[model samples]
Target: MLPDFRLTDRTVPSAIEVYGIQGNAQYVARKAEKQALYAREGAPCVEWIPPDDLASVQLPPAA
Candidate 1:
C-alpha cells in the first residue's frame, strides 16, 4: 500500500494516511481495505481525517 507518509526511521513499519474525501463510496471502501491490510500486517497505521490541520497532527516519535 502507498501511504501518504511513511516513517522509514521507525524500527517497525509505520504509515500515515490522510483521508480527505469522506463521501465517495470508492474512497471509503479503499480506506477500509487499507486499514485491514495494515492490521493484518501488524503495522502501526495512523489515519487523519479532515477538517483537522495536518500541521497540528501529533505524529509518533521517530526511532
Candidate 2:
C-alpha cells in the first residue's frame, strides 16, 4: 500500500518591493501561477524552482 503523505504549503509574501503597483501585482500573480503549476505536476518541493527573472536581480547591502 502507498504511504500516506501531506503536501507542503507554499505561501506568497503579503508585500513585495517592485518598481510600481502593476509590477507588484504581476509578480504576485506569477508566483501563484508557478505554485499552482508545480502542485498540478506533483512537485515535492518548490524551493529549487526559482521564478523567472528573480535570479537576475541584485539586492543592495543591508544597512
Model 1 per-residue lDDT tens digits across residues 1-63? 799998778666579899999899999999999999998988888778999877877666677
Query: Which parts of model 2 are misplaced by more than 4 Å?
Result: 1-23, 48-63
What is the lDDT of every predicted structure here?
0.86, 0.40
Go through the candidates in order and give the clash count of each.
0, 0
For every model shown, what is its TM-score relative to the native structure?
Answer: 0.80, 0.35
lDDT of 2 by residue, 1-63 (tens): 111222223242111223222447775686567556656866433232234466654333322
Worst 10 residues of 1 by lDDT: 53-62
lDDT comparing candidate 1 with the true structure: 0.86
Q: How displaced is residue 56 in candidate 1, in Å?
A: 6.8
